[model samples]
Target: MSRIRIGAGRVTAEIDEQGAELCSLRYGTEGQPGATELLWQAERAWPWHAPLLFPVIGRMNGDRLRHDGTYYAMPKHGFARDRRFTVARHDATTAVLALRDDAASRRLFPFPFRLTVGYAVEGSRLTVSYSVHNPGPGTLPASLGVHPGFRWPLPGATDKRGHTVLFERPEPAPVRRVEDVLLLPERHPTPVRGRTLRLDGALFTDGAVILEALNSSSLIYSAPGSPRMTLSWHGFQQLALWSPPEADLLCLEPWYGLPSPIGSDGEYAASPGQFHLAAGRSRTFGFGVEVSPAR
Candidate 1:
């Protein structure tokens, strides 16, 4: 439950070590009324600031994972968020947290790996990076994603309708969804027309809006008179926007994989978006958030 603070100029952030999560971010110069909250308070239905998804992305059929020759029980989104991560290094502008595969983790995941997460604050932008290394002799198959929730209408805004998500390019692909957290094979036409989606809480009543094979790597969130945040990512294949029904926050997620498609074979290796890491090899995935005054 420890926290690390980092800042650059007028922008500052707080990272919680529990989930190695970014708990808070603020824009505006110090000692002024200009400071505004850019992150949600984890209120309402969900009480997490930012949860890192690893080993598994979404719900597995019956919460079971078939690997090698046995079936193991795995919870949705894996165990990374609930597990404690050790602080590898921390300073004024950057923090590095590390989690390693242990005996207990092996019983659940059956893989030997090391996960390192780093957070850096540069001016009005915060960069979050993840590196996973497969230390064992066998290949490691896993899914990774980032789920960070921002204030829907932002600070001082009264109406959620004033907020909107603007993509870097048009997103015309059919939007996929989940039924009880397991991804449904069918997809609906994207609601985004001309790269924009007007904020509406009702759209998330069932679950998240999943966009597979996105054409854009960046998206902008803005509301009238609020400091807008731009989310940019690389090495991610899917994007999901989610908000619990009536919740005041919207989660913009970058994912490398998705839940098992409908009627999956129940084999982990056959899962969609699962990354294979050769023994002793490492892979990195990252995303950044830049905050600025809305124009």
Candidate 2:
């Protein structure tokens, strides 16, 4: 239950060591009477604030990972979100947490890897970075992702239907969907009209809407008369938009890997969009969030 706090300017963030999860993010001037929380506070509907996804993005087929003719139990979204991370460094506006593969993790993943997460705040923005290293003598097939849920309707907005997401560019490619946590092979028409997506509760009736081939690296979320948020990413090729039906939070996930496709052999390396890191090498991915409170 250990937590670390970091802040700069009008933004402050709280990260928990249990999962290196971002538990809270708020924006307000010093000594202000009201500071608006931009991140979701876990509620009865969802029990997580912002869980990191690693070694795998979504569910493996049958909730099992197959490697070299052996099957190991792997839960949905991998095990990183449930493991503890060691605090590597901390300062006023930055903190770094590290997680290394242990006996328990190796039993599940069968690889020796190191994962480091860094959080930094400056002005009104919070940037999260991830670095994964393969130390074993063989290639490591893995995935990394960030799942941050923001408060829907924002602080000053009354109508949830007024919210919209504007992309940096038009995303006309067909999007993907999931069935029972496994990815469906069929492609569906994009919900985005030009560069804008009108937020609606009905949109998540099935599950997350997965944009496998995202064209934009950044997007803005806003509602009339409410504070606005901008999310930008680097080294992430996929995105998922999700919220429980009628829930009060919206999750914007940027990912470097995907779930095992339905009807495929349960080979771990064959999972779609998996990254193959060579021994002694590393890869990094990151995203940034900037919030502007209503004036």
- Over 1-295, each residue of candidate 2 has an lDDT whose tens digit, in order, gives 8999999789989999999999999899733668778889999899999999988888887888999999998989999999999999999999999999999998899989999999999999999999999997999999998999999978888868789999999999999999887899899999999999999999999899999889999999999888889999999999999999878999999999988887766679888898999999999998999988664
> Residue 148 deviation, candidate 1, in Å?
0.4
Q: Report the error of model 1 at residue 232, Å.
A: 0.4
What is each predicted model's overall lDDT from 0 to 1?
0.88, 0.92
TM-score of 2: 0.98
Alpha-carbon TM-score of each model against the true structure: 0.96, 0.98
- Cα error, residue 29 of model 2, in Å, equals 1.7
Worst 10 residues of 2 by lDDT: 29-38
**lDDT by residue (tens digit), candidate 1, 148-242:** 98887787687788889999999998989998888998889998988998888878977999999699999999888777889999989999999
Clashing pairs in 1: none
Which window of 10 residues has the lowest lDDT sum in candidate 1? Answer: 30-39
